[model samples]
Target: MGFFDRIFGRRSAGIDDPEQLRRQLFDAAARGDLSRLAGLCRANRQAVETHFPAWQKVPEHLRSDPAAMQSHVQVLVAIAQVFAQQLGDASLFQRLMGTPRDNPLMRWQDALRQAQERIDALEFTAARELLTGVLSEAEGLQGSGVDELLPITLGRIGECHFESGEAEQALPYMQQALALCEQAGDADGVRIYLGNLFEVHRWLEQREPAAACARRLAEMIADPTAKRQRLRQAERVAAGEPRNRVLAVIDGASYELDELPPLAAGHVRFMFERDRITLRRATAANEAGEACGGEGEYAEALAHFERAATADRHDPHCRYQAAFTLLHLRRYAEAESAYAEVERLAPGWFHCRADRWLAGRLAAGDVEHDVFLAVHALQDGPMAPDEKLDLAEKTLTRAPRLALLHLLRGTQLARLGREAEAVAAFRDGLAGDGEPDVRSRLLVELATHCDGPQERAALLRDAQAPAGNLVAAATAQLLARGSAN
Candidate 1:
């Protein structure tokens, strides 16, 4: 019928039913009726010897002696183990043996190990039953020295519920375990329970409680670097709602950071500073792009928006602005590519799908613009200077109205050592209604090659009127030079 039945046979070893024999042995041993147990074993001597050869060597007098019942319990436990392993029915074994007292802690550990095995097999009900029974026994021994085992048993019972996807059911058990651990001053146990509570509350989407648990766990961490990292994570999870709560979390994290070891403190501080700089740069570029777009300076807006996107690709709004500005500038292919990225990053945004469609339609019909072609060629750093100049000139011929094309031609001409041609091209682009930042950049370039003091001063002053890092630096240098003279 079953694997065990096939191996042992239905009525082998002279026992008609192994299950009935197991029960009689348990009853006799539990009642301290060694006389009855010996009688039964003697009647089923062949069955006992066949299943357990060691039992044949046990002296007959010891079998009926109450003083030697501890040995009798061991034999019974061994028999129960055999049935549990062969029949895969541990209920009778667990009920009959409970936890052996020959070596109480070792017996408890064995029971826990068996329960874990049952859990691993997805036999959650069996695991829970075993853990509950063990917990009852452990609690009963509270007045004994075994009181320390109660928290561990309670935690195991909670683990059974947690593994079974009954987090709500697991909560009270974990809380009780935590209380006992606290009462016992078990630091490791407290850390473990807090960590478990954090996971449970997070899975339940109870953010506030989860955050509280996270904060407690962070406080329990002993390693300086690990503690700082955990505190940072706790700060993030605790973020939201009333300003006071958020501030409290941040302050707590900051306090922990101050307590970090010197080397770890320096490393974390460097990381924080780098992140802050990156965020500030991205924000400034995004804001500058918005300002330029508001003033209808699409070319300058596109430059700043691209910078913003490069600095922080996670900012969907920056990517979208770059795409929109490219659309206004009639760079359809670039706009389409940018919109595709926006769609990927923010699929559910209200305008993403519509904007993607519009960009796709525009890009399908429009020819590649000369400005885009020239910029692409210049981006190929290995291209010869003459080839770049040719590309720039071709761009100017096709889109004579685009000021950036003129600037491109000027820069390429300057690189080719044609200062006169570069100056003329820069002035031509400066005359058109391009972005102020672009105009300032052109003036700075032109001023660098100017020979006359008056002309250089004028170019620097004009460049200083616009806001840009390069323009500001160039203007300040020239002004300081003039003052020195």
Candidate 2:
């Protein structure tokens, strides 16, 4: 017998399916059938599992998660009210749901991840709604152990607003996040929030506060030359002078914050159009990027790369370099987009998939700066492969644990005529859950390498997915060639 069965000695919950129970309970309540709802609860006092009633269907992760636990307690209170007189026990619900204060953090994780994907699609409004809901939940955890989550949550909401061209709306949240960071003595957090505040304030013509933020940033992140450079921007903002390197007209209403330019000296000039500044033609060499960035001139290096990539959307190198430079500058949020674009432009680009993975982690504030830097610094260096084997080896070692990377590795090895190693790579990539399209492609590739007709058919079957139009077409073409099921 289960724990609940033992506790109540075969008292029938009578409800096997939680979904049907939920429907019946809600229906009963809607029609003012209080007695029936109470009757249902009393009948379900001892389930086979300890979950007793509707709680049985909840995943173990949700049942154990701290944030969900708190919500569960709230649910217990309402249930107790419904069954209070019938069950004659107020503490019974507490025993079922556990003690609760508030913990909104863990409950917000899945929503935040989904929101990041939405943000990646430039669906700012939808992403903002998701983030704002989480932020509202954060209020319930004010004195709880998870209050540390508040600053970052607030900052993300601010970023959503900032990216959607709502500076005034972003200001208060940014300021609050910064203040929380200050209170928490998070120096790095303070530096980041201050940089963001400087961007918003200067754009909003709140120049005095912008100057203050700039000066603070200089104290935090500047080298000697960069120190003087930041001081100059601070001075300009303080004096309400026209901001430097902003090549757009200052009409206030239509002004957009493009890439954050350098504080003092800059390499390339950008022509900011009405909505955004698109990169025009720039003939600067890649070596020039390395040189300029050597002195921690990341802003200028970023500008150089963006310009080089403007009309050359097909060139993955420029976009990858720009993303790397943004990472170096600690502009993680922007780097996420840059790296994502590179991933789309060239999925097989040199370390693009791996770095894009890191960029997401960094943007979500999930990875430490030093950790991200260490991983980034160890990139597969300039894609100069002497042979396909070398390229495959490098890709497997340096790329993210993504099926697409392994697929590339496998394809490269196959081209080099290394059949055994190629098959191994394909199998390794398919070992975990992955993007359906990439997984389908990897499975299709593996199918072609199999010796037996049955094995080949099975692999092809595994590769075929509902959304994989390309893979489905490829599979059909292969099947026509007599590798049939």
| Stretches of candidate 1 exceeding 4 Å from the true structure | 1-107, 120-123, 143-145, 223-225, 240-485
Return the lDDT, model 2, position 289: 70
Tens digits of lDDT, candidate 2, 150-222: 7777887887787666778999999999999999899989999999898778667787998999899989864
lDDT by residue (1-485, candidate 1, tens digit) is 67744445333234567557766765766676554555556567556545443332345676456446565556567555545664454543555544577445556766788987886665666888987876666553322235466677777778777665677898898998899889878898999999888766655556677789877887787897677677665665566322111011131343222333222213121111110112334577889999998888988988888887765544466778888788778877787788778656544232444355546655875324444545545644467788888887776676575555677788888998999999899888877545454566677777776688788877776766523323233343444354336
Q: What lDDT does model 2 reach? A: 0.62
The residue pairs found clashing in candidate 1 are none
- Residue 428, model 1: lDDT of 88
Backbone clash total for model 1 is: 0
Question: What's the TM for model 1?
Answer: 0.32
Please give the range of 10 consecutive residues that has the lowest summed lDDT in model 1: 268-277
RMSD of 1: 16.4
Best by TM-score: 2
